[model samples]
Target: MSDHLVKVSDLQIGFKNEEGELIPAVRGLSFTLGREKLGIVGESGSGKSLTGRALLGVLPPNAVVSASHLSFENTDLLTAPSAELRKLRGLKMGMILQDPKYSLNPIMKVGNQIIEAIQVSNKISKAKAKKAVFDILEAVKIRDVKRVYKQYPHEVSGGMAQRIMIAMMLVRKPDLLIADEPTSALDVTVQESVLDILDNLVDERNMGLIFISHDLNLVSRFCDRVLVMYSGQVVEELVASKLHDAKHPYTRGLINCMPTLNGSLEPLPVLKRDPSWLGAAQIGSGK
Candidate 1:
């Protein structure tokens, strides 16, 4: 068996305009993921979210996706049938979306939703599924598991709702997990708690994590390696600890654009856009 859990090569995603011309959103993105945390950092519309959605085969109907190779645990994602892909989605791979309010069903109780997910992927009875749900909720550090189980989505706080979302995805014990800005909506303390849960779970399960976010500092502290994207293409890759030493001008510009706690009272640096950076994709050694 290969060491890589997910493999994507020369992946391109686009859409057709009124003129039927292909307008690319993700251009030739390639990388391999093992049982490790890999962070993709870039601004909005840089195809960070699209890349994660594409892997789950959840792109919009109008999307035009093509890739030289896209596979999950040796399963050919590009050619997999809808039934196969559907089965793979929650059973072997799970995705934690950015916001729980938008992702969860407003009418359903939280426990029932997670129980439904558990039952869908496994042939367990409701009793067993409920037990699994509670276990996962506790695993994610939800103290009042019983109360949370009966409460509706809106009844819980944003942080608790996000934890519920995490519990739902993790109940299945997937091999690959995609977290699209899971902590983006939480406050600092809650965000730290969420990250701690994710870090512990990933380490304990040996799951491959694709953490998509625009926060370079958070990614550097949490992930093992980083992929810096620009205009739908990867301009640089770096070891997370070495992100500050990024070679690509775009990466450096992004770092410089961040406001420091004690920064000088000057305007933040504006990134100078260069058309040449969008040429051929640059693959870094990630040293």
Candidate 2:
């Protein structure tokens, strides 16, 4: 038994590339996430997003996944029956994905969609469910819940839609949340507000949070720990407060490469990756 809300070990996920060869998207990743928020940072193609999706069993059909140990709330994720996974996903784990355009129903009103998300997890009347939905919206700092709820996905601004997504995902008060670039589509001001909202909700619920992004500076401020991923592998892990002291050359390269407020954008730092990191971990029995 562990205190960590989620644990993963030697996890692997790969898919057939256009060349018809298995290309690993995530390799031998191991980490433990607890009530405090943790950030996974890396450049594009670093497999940060894929790693988070793997935790929730949301990987695509092309993905071939395996793990020695994957558990949430002490239950082995790799072995949990579909029935059990379904129940857990409904009430105990929430995910806010990158694109609400594809995630939300095109024809449904925003309010109905949020209420439906809640009703899917628990038995509640429409009126009670609407109240719960509004409370969540308020928690995320979206005022005029009534107006926004009645509006369609197309009617709301990108930032408003994002807050609604956050609120909807939180309807069940899940113990774990995996936020994949939650604020990428918003303006700078809205991005900061969303970050603050996440900070508050996670603190209030004492939930384990996995925030994935390519932005190292934001992660430094918002998370308790940070994992630096490179070429489908986690090359470094350190306390967020001490992220500047990350040990790996890859981590150093990434930080040195990031753009600064005053620095010109012409020269972006790039890390040189190795090929051997693509190999899969040798699997064992009953993983």
lDDT of each: 0.90, 0.84
In candidate 2, where is summed lDDT lowest over 10 consecutive residues? 278-287
lDDT by residue for model 1 (25-65), tens: 99988899989999999999999999999999999999999
Model 1, position 83: C-alpha lDDT score:
93
Would you estimate the TM-scores of all the predictions? 0.95, 0.90
User: Model 2 over residues 53-127: C-alpha lDDT tens digits?
Assistant: 888888888899998889998889898898998888888898998888877887999999888888888889988
| Candidate 2 local lDDT, residue 190 | 77
Q: Give the number of the best model, judged by lDDT.
A: 1
- Candidate 2 TM-score to native: 0.90
Specify the highest-TM-score model's number: 1
Q: Judged by lDDT against the true structure, how good is candidate 2?
A: 0.84
**Looking at candidate 2, what is the lDDT of residue 147?**
93
Segments of candidate 1 deviating more than 4 angstroms? 284-287
| Superposed Cα RMSD, model 1 | 1.6
